[model samples]
Target: MPDPSLMEQLRADLTTARKDRDKLRTTTLSTFLSEVKNREIEQGRAVSDDDVRGLLTTAIKRRREASEQMRAGSRAELAEKEDQEAALLQAYLPPALGEDEVVAMIRDAVAGGASDVGGVMKAVMPHTRGRFDGKELNRLVREALAG
Candidate 1:
């Protein structure tokens, strides 16, 4: 059987959240679904699962940044809210690779003749994309190349 689209999954989850009276989850999922719909309208077509994943990734990143800024400003309550929202959004993302796993992948790329940082990143990104943070991967690649 074909996989259900990401939007369908999100809508199903939204319904469940509403039924459970999970206000935070219901709000987050609804807002995200609206964003996805807007993007679809812009493109005049249904977006792929990858596109939905990208949108989720962006939302999570924004929440993380806002959480950090709020913490820095000593607003613990607001920071906590952002953290919760980010966690909710992250539930839809693919699990991230561990540091050791990422390091191993970088080593393999370097061994495969990716000598410079840029070359290693280019080699590793395709394997790591959506499963790892680019900044963390870049740092690991640099350390692997330098060592």
Candidate 2:
């Protein structure tokens, strides 16, 4: 009747991946699940969906960096595999904000008197954190302040 939590969704998808014999999906989901479990154990409390989203974002970032490194090292096959894993992890994240949407948010932040880069970033990061790249957000905020 209700949508499952991210943790629950990952667990269910992990089971499905196992059943479907999708090794990449199975491995990715299991590693992500293990990170979620580790955090819960470390904190002695269950993570909220936001916490899971943070983990997903971190995992995806790691995968993307690894992909880049592999590509630079000329390991084409490994790079391709890492890219695949990154794409797989990307699916679990909330859809990214478009340029227009981000610009609108930046405008609102600036209008709210976050006229400096640091101020604008502090104002907007909470809203954009897991769904947006910090570098891109910072650039947008700078653009808003300038124009």
Candidate 3:
């Protein structure tokens, strides 16, 4: 048999989560898999691993935002739930770039004559794509440029 794709691995993990009675993992993986399938159907092509990763990243970001909003509204329990879900989803994402790594990339871009915010951002994003958050990268670039 062919090696399982990342999506298949995720499905297998979902099954394991179900067997282990991990409600949060099971629910999050199931929902994410559903969205992946929906996107495949809409696009009429097999979704690549990168596409699935993009979807997972978006889901995690939404959960983070929801958690923040819930906390701001004093809904601690809901906020915790959102945080848990986000963490579960994050398990499937590629490891994020470390702070030092991001800073190094920013420094390289700045040294390469990307002095302005937009120029540095444009130079750094292609290198950081799918590995770091844009807002975080933007902040780091601004700091590097300012300092």
Candidate 4:
């Protein structure tokens, strides 16, 4: 489980988000917390830090996909809204790994004979989950494999 202090901070942020009338953020975070609670209940234990991070990563990925689709559909306003929600969601994440870092990790995976996309992804993903978007990381890994 995450430290009590970390969960407290999340609770405080949820309150702040609500008070600030950030509807998208408020909704997204509420749903996130709810999901965490649900999973915790399912497991009969408090949610671990990794579990919370994974949930946040999933939420972020979904928002990113919606944002992309919105843009592709000529719905710039909706895309911008999704982008804002994404940024708000990201506020809770650890610092993202840089391109150099990602590339170096992928290189290490390759050196370990993770030349196939699945192998490389499985090897490198644990390092970035919750801190980096998976699809973006996958794209980078594909580029690394090709090169």
Judging by lDDT against the true structure, name the best candidate.
3
35-141: candidate 2 lDDT, tens digit per residue: 99999999999999999989888888888888889889998899888788878888888888888888888888888888689998888888887788888888888
lDDT per residue (tens digit) for residues 36-86 in model 4: 889989999998777887877787888889999999999999999888877
C-alpha lDDT (0 to 100) for residue 20 of candidate 1? 100
Clashes of each: 0, 0, 0, 0
Clashing pairs in 2: none
Model 3 lDDT per residue over 1-147, tens place: 987778989999999999999998898889989999999999999999888888888888999999999999999999999999988888777788898998988888888988799998888877676679989988888788778
lDDT of each: 0.87, 0.87, 0.88, 0.84
lDDT-better candidate, 2 vs 3: 3
What is candidate 2's local distance difference test score?
Answer: 0.87
* Backbone clashes, candidate 4: 0
Model 4 scores worst on lDDT over the 10 consecutive residues at: 2-11
Question: TM-score for every candidate vs. truth?
Answer: 0.88, 0.94, 0.85, 0.77
Instruction: Report how far residue 34 has shifted in candidate 4, in Å.
Output: 1.6
Clashes of 1: 0
